[model samples]
Target chain A: MKRYLKICMAAMIISGLLLSGCGKKEKQDPDSTSQSGVMKVGMVSDLGGVMDQSFNESAWEGLLRAQNELGIKIGYLESNNNSDYGPNLESLTDAGNSLIWSIGFMMGDAALEAAKANPEQKYGIVDMAYGNNTPPNLISVLFKSEQASFLVGYIAGRMTKTNKVGFIGGIKGFIIDSFDYGFHAGVNYANADVKILRQYVESFSDAAKGKSIANQMYQQGADIVFHASGPVGDGVIEAAKEKSKWAIGVDKDQNSLAPDNVLTSAIKRVDNAIFNIVSDLQKGKFAGGATVVYGLKEGGVDIAPSSDKHVPKEILSEVAELKTKIIRKEIVIPYNAKTYEKFYIAKQ
Target chain B: MSIKAKLTNWSNSAKRYLDNTFVFTLIAIFIGLITGAIILAFAGFNPFESYWAMAVGIFSKPKYIIYTIIKATPIIITGYSVAFAFRTGLFNIGAEGQFIVGGIVAALAGYFLHLPPVIHAMVAFALAVGAAAAWGAAAGYLKARFGVHEVISTIMLNWIALYLSNYLVMSPAVKRAESEATHKILATARIDLFGVWKVSEQGMAWRMENRFFHDLLKPDINIGIIVAILLGVMIFLILKKTTLGYELRAVGFNKDAAENGGINVNRSFMSSMAIAGGLAGAAGALQVLGVSLECVNLSNMEGYGFDGIAVALIGGNTPAGCFLSGLLFGALKYGGGKLQSMMGAPREIISIVIGTILFFTAMPKLIRYFTSRINQKREEK
Candidate 1:
């Protein structure tokens, strides 16, 4: 009887905690009937939900802006795992969304399959290009992330007092290789004597690993660290706060995470690209079967506004100059090891 | 009739009803629904409408039902693995590792082997099951030889299997060029029903004429669910009728008694683990051949094996119980996503409801206590 009483008590307490803790609910827009001409845009997020504070967040922000400024009806479905991708896309299609967006490169194959199956529906994917085989109804959004990484590298190169900087990547892949090579090129261009330590967390979500790697680099006399490793950068910033060193953010303005310790962010304007594409759809100018690349010249990437707070005025001016050079094609930023070598020889 | 006599009669009937497992399970399910409704209402959504939408999501189309069944297949098999071990008084926490080992072997065999169409898939399935059985038997061997607790050893093996699979997926020899996953398995290794013919032009033309069959085959319709059901029936028979089953159950009841009665206790442990591991490995093989068709680098455990524990508990460690509970869970999972899509409700609510149900189902003692208390109050009155 005592054991029975204990079990009963435990059940009641667990249910009570759940009720009290989950009372705060998210605000949702009331369901509206789809009008004949009103375009409904639906988005499917990857495993990272809309609040990932990175790529997914930026895409969601863009959708919200479209809802406000363009007066379009917008909805989104968050995926729980890889298997959810196809079904989520199908649900949106069945709901009569005129345009659908798949967030992240991980959803590339799913998006492609969905587009092929439903040729009448227009689809777009972020950070994935199908190259020559892009379907007639799909648009691929690509970012010249290397161009943005170069500007932040310039800042780190100019500001480091220890003449040693570090680069932390999420995974060793084509996407991350661009960030690595671009940072290395920028560092060399600014100060040839400065050394850059590099490491890959091999995972985007492992913050503990990221923090440890950043700590080690700082201990090795690196004054600043730059990371392009999604959520792992949060740990890098925390490490920077602890060590009183500099950390550069990626994807969005993350100065709020560590304020004084964060020098700046390499901002990839996914929101801008998404907003522009939706605006094009509104204007009856859907550019399907094509890959749209956004570089510094296209106003798709830039340094965060918070850069001026930490970076010296002269260094900011130099970064602005470098940005112009990249835009004008006067400086060709390397995005891989082989290209980086050629760029290095040309600099010499 | 006096008031006291009538109250006693009512309490007696209520106690009898609570003693029935089926009725008790229904009551637990009712409590879980109420909990979900309360959460939904507090979260600014109409609970009735949300539940209506979830039901519609599952049953509105044949394809949806097919999809739910597809999702339930692997978990059902894994649940059997857990139930099989539990019946023999062994905790098989290593089902996750065995499942991964099976998947890795299946993917390798599917990709590298070039056999006849039916034979290729069968060979891959055989290799996967054998590998996982070996993986499970290793833990049993340690327990028999060195008196190692299976719970700790299996947990450690789970991590090793995860990292080893990851290493294999990343190796250039197995990795697909320009992708994070392995190469898609060869066409000969696919186990989908009419997979090759379904997408052909002639098949599409035929599908246009047969609307029902088209919708039924819309998802990756495979034989996995059928195989899982057959396996459940087979396990039920084996446990009920076989001499081996008697020995395993005897060991589970009392090892010393079983040993004195001439049963080989050590052999029973190894055989029980091997069979459980084989069931888990079959799940991975079927998933590879029927669903994803290749292995992706897993960031974390997929949780199928973990969910198997819940299924086994809810099932009362019976094969039939696992099958039913697996379907229940699969429907909840696949249908729950519709709440977010249709009504903008958060997905975490589904987890809460499932957790609450599992909690109630697991604590039969609390239900018995409440029933007795009610009887006591009635007698006092």
Candidate 2:
């Protein structure tokens, strides 16, 4: 038995070594593409995958736009988790993709590392801004989804029958907190007496949790609930349908997901950012070093047009007026609760 | 010799090969690969090219090797956690909870404590492992004292760990100001070897000249890999050589018999679980101080704890087996990105392959049937 075990161990080691030796001889040949003279663009999706019908999907649409109009060849890898980001980026870069786009803030560190490793490989990441000194080969794209959420909050405050609005957030972070605080600020801006309740589902994918939380808020006399929780927001819409209350959508115009129930969506144009960056890269005018802020003024953040035709024209006009003031620097929107508290205190 | 005699001798050799556990494992592996190939063919992909790309992707780049080792380090400990419990006749589904608690404590210790470099890492590690062991022991106590099913309790504890860690991260004292994660671990607490490298122009020039060497020298390759291997060996020695190990195995093989023979079965159960938890806790602490952004910023469980179950299962419930299996899983995970880009395949395909491999490994009846067939041929001859 001892001799047999030794032979087995030796065989295992030999096979393992042989497998690795075979890999070394291959030298990794890059896949050849038929699209001559077209720039190769690679997009790496977050764990939500490309078919998420939200942020990741919208980003893919932008890449599709570049593929069709700008004649760039596009390939996408859907990351399974946070750990996949680095490997996905490296694989895309190794495959001769000159420009790579990584969606979401989760890829911030991975993209930063990849940028440092291959200085010539240009990268664009969504919802991330490197403080001050970003790598010269990377461009961080950020959207003021809070500004759009603020507009939706104003609409909710204007339309609610109970003078109470609710917000369901995905997780606690700067990005998600922006939505929460902006919604609160907007509700108070519209009506200081309006009560704004808040809760977080603590996940981007748990729609059932989102539904239960939304139902609780509706039970507490909140007639309108806005959610910034990716697919989880779908559950909020479902709960709104059950309660016959208004639900605000996010990321894209999700009105079509539940037409009559959705008041409007807080649109963050990930597609536009991706398309614009790829276009710039193609045109030899890529702005790499600087962080790009895509806010309401940039048309990268806006409230989707309401599918409900009966939306009061006066309310629409008022929102448009507020958008102009925001663009003109007359109203500085708060992105966090502390700043919003200052605005609330000053009003008092 | 007659032809029948020669045929009998050949069949006898075949039976000897079939009787070897190592050979049976290799056969299972071969079948698993074939199964993966069949699935890929049905899915309209060339299995050879895809697998080749995966192999090259992981080994062709020096940085990729480091990444694979880094990825394997945590799972290796977690695998041992599950394997150790399995050997003691306990199911440690609570490895996830133990891992999370360990990470939370380590992150807190790393952020709050001030000590010299080596001492800081050691203290943080000890705090994490001790907390995790206590957390795991609670489940063991519930089982021994109240006869509660550990499976149900461990599963419940996983959710508790998740929410508890989430709450801790949100607290003002633990949370970094204006950030989702806790404040970065002090330099003294960092486990990366590159942190201790002396700065010199010669070193800088050498790094810049060779990209591969520069990557190998980066802080990405943490000391956790060495710790993982050492722990694996330690567990192996304890299981194979110690008196306590003999008692633990006896209790595992037959708790009633071991108790009748004057063995402390309850104590064995608690100690085994505590050890398992310690391994899992070490995995969590190493991950936080070594791998993650140097702080715990997990919105959800990282899934390494769950993956350890698969690693232990594939490793055949032994420390050395767990280590090797952990490395295999790590390579598959790190290579999946290449498979996606090169073959236009979903990364989910890697899961299918791993599942198939485990399926084969778990099926003893299949191996028995093959061995019986060879025996029948020998008898006929």
Candidate 3:
């Protein structure tokens, strides 16, 4: 009887301690009621996590800006796999975030499903093109990344002394396919005789594989290599430095990684798009249920600054003119593999 | 001896079994939970709230419970793979590689085969299991033939399987149109939720009409969990009630003795590894057939095999224990996601807690010391 009583007492004490552990000291008077006017923004990252220095990172920068300038509360969840997209978005919604941003095309299905499930919640996804049947609360934001890739490709085509250049892609998806096709069109536009080699490392984070592939391309007479492989592009720049070749980056300006070897970057302004969307939302102009295309005309995509001394003055001017022509729709560069044939046939 | 003495002897034996593993495991779990609470407190999060949220998160919603079960299905099989190998005195770190091979085979079979509804899914799963068995047996053969440690062979095999799967998935023949995954299998081949036939028009009509039944059963609950639990029971029966299992245990107890006693030790090693591989393959098959619906486009290890090791260790290498431990781990994983959103803590802390649990579970001395102290105090009182 004594032993049983002792055990019961111990159990009671433990439960008491455990229950007290939930004591709240600094919860800020229940977040939703106090911050009625302030907006709550949530961001979901792709498989590359929050710090990939690419699309996810750029989107996070936009969220941070909104928090600092607009006085909005922000939270982010990083996904380790594709399956996490739906759950992460749902979690953010459950947290009562008014607006959510999903980064990358891989999130299209998950975001679409979530948007369908919760028609009242507002969502904006980057790089995912929703045709005509998009949910009323979800907005799809697309970037004409090819417009930027074209300028960099033209530079590569003209700068290659051996008449050979290369392109390295992270994965064989629609977005990467756009970069590849646009680069092909640009190379053909510059010099049809130049050879372009392509390789996919099949991952966004494999820097070593990126370096090896870039090195091999450089060794095989390719003087310039452009990569759309996120962090893998850093390795490409590293290879370019070692081999005295030029490397073109993607998503953002990466010339700082290797100032001398990096020719330019195919810059896609994801941060600008995100900031503009949230800013518009703040101003009571929440543009939902529409596909917003950020193209060259909108300054959504561009070639980063590269010195004329590195790229020939004539080639630079020609590339700049080509960019204007593309913006004007005078030269419609192919954004996908199927459309590339028509462009190629016209060039021939 | 009298009847009382005989009853006491039986109770003593039962107590011995509990002392050997069960008590230690329970104590370990208690310590691990307490440590996790302390860590949460140190991190300025409400430990009770986080744990309560995790518990309620996994059980409060029917969908969450189904999700937990779904998550457990594959790991349960993989845990069995590890547990079965351990019982045979082999460390099967190669479950990961074997699972990948099995997953790839299942994907291929699911895509290419044109059989009827039930037959197609079963055939695909069986083919996957066979392929994974072959992969596992190859490592075992190497260990038997050239004295290569199963550990090294399995690790190397895992890398080979990863690269091989990657190459195959990327090939033009297998690669899906404009996507990283392969083409989705025919509806006939899918092991859909509730064992519902997904192909025939009649089956579709029936399933649509039975929406109430589906809801009652929880539409998200798939056949994988059923298969995992059934396999666990069958494995337990096999180990306890069969001559083959008896021989296998003998080999595990003393390989040289088993060999001298006319049991082929080399054959046991090969067969045990093969069976272990088959279990892992079942996990892979269930994952592709039921969960991801493709090879899942993994750029790195999917972690089921590695998690299996933890499940097996915590389970004390028993079939029934593996099933329960698998569920526990799965609950942690499923609930961890909710905990992160609820408490705003990093999900990595869940992994740390899991690791701490495994650490405590591995140390039987800690449990023995505590239990002995408790017993001494009770006697003194």
Q: What lDDT would each prediction earn against the true structure?
A: 0.85, 0.81, 0.82
Q: What tens digits encode model 1's per-residue C-alpha lDDT throughout B230-293?
A: 8899898888899998888888888899999999888988998898989999998998898888
Among these predictions, the greatest TM-score belongs to 1
Candidate 2 lDDT at A193 equals: 83
Tens-place lDDT digits, model 2, residues B213-296: 766664356899889989998898888899888888898899999999999988888888889889999999998887663444
* Candidate 3 residue lDDT tens string, A1-348: 224335545865886676655434323434654377878888888887777767788888888888898888787887876556866787677667788999988788779867765667899999997888787899889998888888888888777789999999988888898899989888878888899999998777678889999999998999889999887887899999998888988887787788889888888888888988998988888778899999899878888765454677897888888878987899998989888998888777
- Across residues A173-282, which tens digit of lDDT does each residue of candidate 2 receive? 88888888888888888887899889987667778889999999999999999999888898999999999888999999888888889888899999898888888887
Candidate 3: segments with Cα more than 4 A from true spot: A1-16, A20-38, A185-194, A201-208, A305-332, A337-348, B1-20, B37-49, B194-220, B365-381
List of clashing residue pairs for candidate 2: none
Largest lDDT belongs to which candidate? 1
Whole-model lDDT, candidate 3?
A: 0.82
Error of 2 at B289 (Å): 1.9
Q: For candidate 3, lDDT tens digit of each residue in B240-350?
A: 899888888888899999999999888888999999999999999888887667765566897889889989988989998999889988888878877776666775787
Candidate 1 residue lDDT tens string, A243-291:
9999999989989899999999988899999999998999999999999
Look at candidate 1 and tell me the lDDT of residue B114: 97
DockQ of each: 0.20, 0.28, 0.25
